[model samples]
Each structure stands twice: as structure tokens, then as C-alpha cells.
Target: MQDEGISRARFLAAGLAGAAGALLPAGSAAAKERWGLSYRGVCYEVTDGETAETGWNATRMRTDIRAIKDRLHADSVSVFGDGAGRLKATATEAAERGLHVWLQPRLADRPPHEILDHLAETGRHAERLRRQGARVHLSVGCEFVLFVPGIVPGADAVERIRNLMSGNYDPQQMMRRLTAFIAQAAKVGRSVFHGPLTYGAAEGDEVDWRLFDLVSVNYYSYFQDPARHVRELRKYQRRHKPVVVSEFGSCTYKGAPQKGGMGWDVVDYDKPKPEIKGHLVRSERTQAAYLTGLLDVFEAMGLYAAMTYNFVTPDAPHRRDPRYDLDMAGYSIVKTIWGTENDPTSHWHWQPKEAFHALARHYARPHRRLDPA
Candidate 1:
């Protein structure tokens, strides 16, 4: 019988051999090194509050951006905004940190029919950030099939999400609709903001690469075979264009590695503050291991950039009681706790998991030489 357990590094590299045919020419190693860590970043989130006063957190937001640059060692940051105001606030601060900003406008409660309006608003923010001497790339939207309307046949986001989950829609049809929307979004984004533009394609979504400056994908390709996923990603590095992993991460749980992309929905949101209540086990190392494996693949693959799913989660806080342990549902590297003020700027209010150090270390290493594309 074959040995069932594989070392993390080998496990990540195992699938690359099959991808050799798809890689950039071996002479492109110098180019890959020159483009090292193109977007070493994290997704920073900001949502509109019920009211203006409570809608944003300026103090904490400032602190988070500082920490993202100083502590997290991120050179690029993706500010995920719900509306124009939120995007401006987050992206402006990210710019202040001397990090390139990928300004993305999001619509959580709304339908896909409003994507054009939302992208228009985001373009305004992108222009504003650019005017302020900030390096900003306008990412018009993310995962439209799940977030937007009309692409998947649901009347609203919830219905469409359920439709997707139920496997009740046609995949090919869904792709066509999604492609059309992405192309439209790119067109709209270009009209307002004449800068680098991209759309965060959901993993496994076949996108038209010619429409955008960067080929970005939100890759959470399960936990079983990373090499195979890297090979798949390698195929997308066509036209000598940069391929970016816009978002990829796992949660902090014992079985999170196996949950893959489903980890986010594994816990019920409305059930309670800490949706997962039980004699639950927390696995910081599991999160770290999964990340390290992916980073290994990313480094060897000579991808342009990779932004982890997120940086902080003020919404998800840690708790002593298992019933209130919302951090279990978070993708944040730091586990924050509400009402626990450390009185000043410190990583104390939030606890950094093992993955935090692993990321810092991986990023700090010299860029690996990669095959030329």
C-alpha cells in the first residue's frame, strides 16, 4: 500500500510536473523574479452600517491598516467596500500605509441587477484614490454568480445562492451569464477609471482573459490535492498576462482543511453569535498548514500575486464559552474579541494564529526563481 500521508511541501509540488507543459518558458525565470510578490496582500473589509455614525469604525480601521503594513508585512491590500464611502475610507487608509490598493465595491444585501451601479461607484472611489497619489487598481466585483443577480436564475442573492447550493442550475449557462456580466463590468470600470482593472472570478469559473488587465481567481481548491489546483491555475497564465489569486484561505478549525471552500458556510450564521456551539476543537495549526501548502505552490508556480482572503474580522470575536466562539467562523488571521480593549494599539486585543507567522516568514523569504512565462 502507498503511504497515505504526504509532507506539506511535496504534497503541494506533486501536481506541478503535469503542469510543465502549461508553464511559461524556462527563460522567463528572470521576468518572474522581477515581478516577485506583485500583490502580496490581504482583503480588508468595510461594510455600510445602519447609520452614518455606526456605519464605519475609523479608529479601529486606522489601526487595522497600520497593522496590515507593519505587522502583517503586506505590500498590497484589497479594500472590499459595500458602497462608495466604505471603499474610500478603507482604500485611502490602505494607500496611506504605502500599499497598493485593489478597490472593490461589494453589494451583500442587494441583487446582481445593481452591479453596474455599484461598479460605477467603485470607479469613482478608484479615481479619487488615484488622484490622492495612491496606487489603486479597480476590481469592479467578485464572484458574481453567487453575489450578483440574474447570472444564476435566482430572483435575489439568497434565492440564487440556494439555487447554486441545490445544484438546480445549469453550469454552462451560468458561466455564459457570468462571463457577460464580467465583460460588462470591465467595460464599465474602464469607462470611469483608466487604471489596471480586474474581476475576482470564483474558483472554477471560466473567464475571458482578454477583457481585463489581470487574470484573477478566488482559489480555494479544496484541501486534498493542491498540486492539481496549481496545475489548473498554471493553465490560466496565458497571453503572458499575470495570474493572481485574488482570494484563498481556510478557517480555524480541526476539519477546516477538508472543508475547502465550503468552510465559510459550514457554520450557520443566524443560529447564534457563535454559530458553532459544542465541545468544539480549534486548530490554529491546521489553518497554518493549509496556508503554507498553498504558499509553496504559489512560490513555485511564478504567479503574479496572491492575496489571502482577509486580514481582520471585528465581527467574529473569540470567546471562552464555546457557544460564543464566533472566531471559529472567521477567516481572519487574528482572532478578535469584542469588549476586550487593550487600551492602545497592540495585537493583544486580537490573537494571531499560527498562520500569521507562517505568512510573514513566507513573504519575507527572497523571491524564488520561477520558469519564464
Candidate 2:
């Protein structure tokens, strides 16, 4: 499933049992750490805040970026968020640590000009990072049909999603409009950033390959066979460019593997209180297995990079009551909580789900060798 319309919820704290050691054997022999973790959770509302991670705290961000490089062992990170200033702040932290930075501008539910303006502004900052000797890639934007305006007749992403679900729009027309916008975006990016340019596409988006320096897709193996999904990579391979799966993973629940990419849908945001829609068992191992299994397949398929869905979602923190638990519906690897909840004396604000250790081990292996594309 694509990241068509993920409901944005403002939240995060609570506690639950997680299998920090229940790791399934990888689908194939463990390969080295070519994987990059996408940091999609930093949402600073013009305030200061840590794994002790509320928002834009200098000390807290240092720890977060360090964990991505040192703990997760990721060599690159795709940093994105609501504001360009915050996104740049996060990306700058990642860049200083000797990690490749994919500076992605993700301004959702905004007008087209605002989104483009964000990209151009962010691109200039990314170029400076590159010129300063940091490896930076300017990802124009992502999932345009849902995020960008005019592609569909809706004021925002959620409305566009509902309208599309009613199946009343023309597919060809949607792509035609999206394709033109992407072209314009690429042009805008080139005007400000002079490094590699790519745009995040959904698994099935027919973006013109010529417009990107690399082929990027949010390939969530949602209810789909990993092998079948890898087979679908052939068409992308035909593009003769690096193929990067920018967004891929499972939710933290017993049956989340079968739900579509928007599996977090189980949480009902409509109610006054955050509540799980039905009975559900929390299983961090399920999320871990789904990710490890995909890493094995992606390694074997020689994909350039398989960045995970996200590092942490502080807005959707863990909770003790399943009815109130928001982390189960999040795609992050860590369970965020109120800092004081962990320990009144401790600064740590999160607990690792089973996937955390699994990924650390997977990425710590000997370097993987790939055949030329």
C-alpha cells in the first residue's frame, strides 16, 4: 500500500510489554548495512523539546541522530517533516555526523505554491550542505497525488483520499497532472540545488524516470509477498538507475502484516479521545520479522537502498491501555513516551521495540556485494 493518506495525530506516552529479544532468523544470510533510516517523526511546533524526543531540542536531536548512525548503523537518512526550518535542522545534524542526507521536504495539506516554495528553500540549504562536503540529495517531495493540490479536487490530503476511495476520478488525468507537477518540481529543485535529485513515488506511481537521478518509491510490502514485490522491481531496474525503496515496514500489532500501508487506520482519530477501534494484540516481533524478511529479499534483489518507514513517531506514543495506545498504530521502531514515565530520574523517553535490535544486528553484518545494474 502507498502512503496515500496517513492520518496525522498529535500525541505520544504509555507502557506495554514488548519482546526486545524475540527475533526471527532473517529470510536470507545477513547482509551489510547499506540501509538508511528515514527520520519522519520530528515535528517541532516552534518549540524546544529527546529520547528525552518531543521536538526540536539541540541535545535531544544529537542523541537521536547518533542513534540512527551508531545504534541503527545506518549510513544515510531521509529527513522530512512539516516545516523546512525544522527539516533543515534535523538534516544538518545528520549531515555533520558523516551520513548521507536525503533532504526531503514534506509539507502536507498545503497549497501547491507553498509546497514548492518549501522545496526550493530546503534545496538551497541542502546545496550548501553538499558544498560544505556533506553528501546530500534533494528529494523534491513525495506522494504528490495525495500531498500536492490540484491533482485531485480536495482541500487537503484526507479529503483527496476519501474522494479517491469513492472512485469518481480519472486515473489518466491524475497522472497527467502529477507528471507535469513533478517536472516543475524538478526544475525548481535544479534552480537551487545542484546535486542528485529524486522524488519519492508510491509503489505504483508512473513517474517519468528521466526526471530523477535515482528511482525512489515508498514500497510498503503491505499484505503483499516480499518476493512478488521484488519482482515488481524489474520495471524499476529497467530504468538503469539506483533503485531506492524510501518507505517500507509494518505496524506493531498481531495482524498488521495483512493490513494495507495505512494500517495505522485501526486508531479512530474522529473520537474526542485516542482509541483503538477494536481488539488488537501488540506484537513488536511481528513488525521486526516483516522488516528483517524484507531486508533479506531487498539485499538479494540488489536494490540500492531500503530505508525503513521511520525512526520514531513521538506524536503517536505508546500507552498501557490498548484502547488508548497510539504506538501500535505507528510505523516507528521505538515506543515513545513521556520522559518522566520511563523514570522520573532518567532522560530516556523511548523503549526499543523488537525491531530495534533486529535492525542493529542486520545492519552490523559484513558489507553486502551487489552486481552492477
Candidate 3:
């Protein structure tokens, strides 16, 4: 699932000073509303389809949504991908199931107009969902500099990333374009969407928080200095808006936690067929420990929400062949399996990985009040 960061209007009061005591853990019941998951059920136009996450089945989506609420016990979900209709359906389903909806419409590598048009449609639908008694927030977009155009070179995110690494592009100019685009997105989104608005930002996006209602960052921390994660988060603190970690997770391989967001770099795309570039040991426990440790960080930080990168990546099916298996590069908590008709009672084709069980246990724990004493 494609997930972004969360803002805590759902739980935040006037300011952090007033909000801090309530949000910090003292062991009552999770403050009861911070856990969330990313649903990558519909990334409309992924380049090369590196991820197999965009398998949209209503039954499966609903089941996954239910699991986020019922099984994983997530308080909310950030919906990613394109197609206004699909976004509406998935978000509505999640909302009706009583999970808060972070309605993020990811129209990747499209013209700016197309992207905005998608946001307009999704915003209207989100507004409708909110009016219909659902807790909904519209994330204008995610990673404009990477996904949207004119910031850097290249047609898709991959090319842009490569181009960015080459240092041929101008950073100041890129930020200028990105910052402006985000402002326009916020303005356009606000016209149709009459609720709290958030933008799913990269760690270094430098987004103007004033344009948004809350701060939502897709932060994947390399496990070098865990305390440094806390310091970086505090930088985003606004007087009232709650800061959230939108996306964070590791690939199911050893030492992935140290690489953070770059964990996916292990894949050898240059090969005729995709495979691990080198000998890498698969360790689900490494991913599990990394994820749980961050959850602890978020919990301790009293964040608005901490949404792991995703629930499942269906395109990247788990294979016994380590060289062929795509799940090793994914951040999904569940490993995708193939089988529908064979299983009479299930619409989903996934097995719980170590991270899933670990998260379930973490989420199921009692959270204390996030309200001031």
C-alpha cells in the first residue's frame, strides 16, 4: 500500500505544549489514534512497474482495509495511486469501515493538468466522504519534485532520481518549481476539498508548512542514530499542526534498516530479468525490528500518525528463488502469494511477514490518553 505521513487535527489541540502531555506515552491505550497504514492498491502509472502493488480488487481492497482496522488495528489509511473512481471507491470503503482516510491520489509521471484534475476529482469525493460522516483528509500529492515534472529532468521518477544524483540540475531552481507547484496544489485542492489538507513530502522537500494545514513527511530513517530521528522530526514542529511520519520501512534483507529508503537500491534492474544485484541475505526479522523500533520512536515523539510504507505489494510475488523474488525489495508488511479460487474464504493472496505480526502486536497494545490531564 502507498502510505504518506499523518497530521493530528484528529487528536491535536491548540499547540504542542498543550498537546505534548497527552500525546507522550504513559501507558493508558496508544493515545488511541495514531497508527496507520499505506495502501498502494492503485498506483496508476508506475514506470517499469518496479512494484506490483497496484492490483485493484474490490474484495481484496476491502479485506485489506478491514485488516488495517480489524487485523492490524490501524486507526487510518493513506490511499495512494491514480484513477479518481478507484480512489473514491477505496477511500469510501475504508471510511465506511470506520478507518480515517488519507485520500492521496498519486497520478505519477503525468502532465501537471492531469495531476491537478485528478486531485480535483479526488478532493471532491473526499469532501463528500467527510460530509457523509467519515473522517477524511485530502493529501494534495506526494513527492512533486520526483513524481511531477519540470522540477528535475527525466520523464519518470527513476530517471529523475538518476538525473538528480548526477547533479546536472539546479537545486534552487528545483525547489522553486516544487514549492510553487505545492502552493498551487494546495490552493486548487482547497477549492474543492473542504477539509484538512496535507502533502506527503520527501525528507528534504522543504515544503512551506503555511500552505498546508499540517506537516506530513515520508521519512525513512537509516538506523544510524535513532535519537537523530527525533531531532529531525522536531524540525517540522509547528505551533498547532501535528507532525507525522508518512512512510517508513525496510526491505526484507539483512542491513536494509541501515539503508532506510534506499533499501530498494539492491535490485538489479539492468539485468534482462530483475534480480538481486549481489549476494544478500534475506532476513524478515531485520525488517521487523526496524519497523517496530520506528514505531517506538513515533510513539515516544507523540506524533500525529506513523504510517508504514505499505500493507502489501501484490505485483512483487514472493518466490522461493532469492534471485527472482521481488518481495525482498518491497516495504510491504505482508508477502504476496498467488491463489484465489483455491482458497474458498479469502480474496487476498498474501501471507503475513514478520513485520505484520510485529505490528499487530504493537498496535494491539493499550494506548493512553492524548488529551491534556
Best by TM-score: 1
lDDT of each: 0.71, 0.70, 0.71
Q: Write candidate 3's Cα lDDT for 1-373 as tens digits.
A: 0111211111222233233335334443333344332221111111223323344667667778888788787766888787787788888888888877788888888899888988899899999998898987789989998899888988899889889878978989998899889998999899998888889999877888888776889887763434556566666764356666777778888777667777888888778767886887787877877777666666655667767887887666677788867789888889877453222123337888988888888777766433212
RMSD of 3: 7.5
Give the TM-scores of the predictions, in the order they appear. 0.84, 0.82, 0.83
Model 1 CA deviation exceeding 4 Å by range: 1-7, 10-36, 49-55, 109-113, 155-159, 223-226, 269-274, 277-280, 340-348, 366-373
Task: Give the runs in model 3 whose Cα sits over 4 Å from its true position.
Answer: 1-54, 339-348, 368-373
Candidate 2 is scored at a TM of: 0.82
Question: Which pairs of residues have clashing backbones in candidate 1?
Answer: 28-372, 29-372, 49-55, 112-149
Which residue pairs clash within candidate 2? Answer: 11-315, 12-317, 14-319, 50-53, 51-349
Q: Sorted by lDDT, highest first, which candidate order results? A: 3, 1, 2
Residue 67 lDDT (model 3): 80
